[model samples]
Target: MTRFPLLAGAALLALATSASATSFVATTDTLGGLTANASESTSDISSSFDDDKIVRAARDDAASFVASNGAIRGAQLEAALRHIRQQAPQVQADDQQLARAILAL
Candidate 1:
């Protein structure tokens, strides 16, 4: 019985090793024998977003969420504020301010 379990474990280990050996490697166009020119374009990225617009959007979304849910607290509040920070790092508002805004509704 103990020997049977050991044999089964060895068989599974062998099968896993063999399966891993045949596993496919994922490749993209860059890795598939194609050369792509890498260029950094600063204009389009910065020009597309206006600072005021981003701040306004964040505030509006927060207000709407607070209104719908009545309030943001605990993990939900932390996640929402984190999202706002990630979306607009340059925005002047801090987590405390955002939390107050959410609760003010």
Candidate 2:
């Protein structure tokens, strides 16, 4: 009974070590300069968004603003400004200036 437990523990340790040693591989085959399938496209887009979270967030906010404002010029500007601020809080002065410009238009 004790030997059975020892063997099980050894097997578990080996499994863990092997799993840790395994490497992940990523490859792509481009056909006419485009990705092969929708999965690849989604993966690529997701990776890009992950890298540029702030930019993506800003763009999303801008789109939301446009959507909520009923295509009105003033609402469009406010939305854009709000989005920029939300996405890039480090640029307060720039956000204010952009908000003014958008409101004016």
TM-score of each: 0.28, 0.24
Worst 10 residues of 2 by lDDT: 23-32
- After superposition, candidate 1 runs with Cα above 4 Å error: 1-73
* Candidate 2 Cα lDDT to native: 0.46
Per-residue alpha-carbon lDDT of candidate 1 for residues 1-105, written as tens digits (9 for 90 to 100): 799999999999999987776563334544543322211111222232335343334555555555666354455555656655676565555454554444333
Candidate 2, 11-97: lDDT as tens digits: 999998776665321222344334345334434333433444343434443444445653333444455455555654544244333
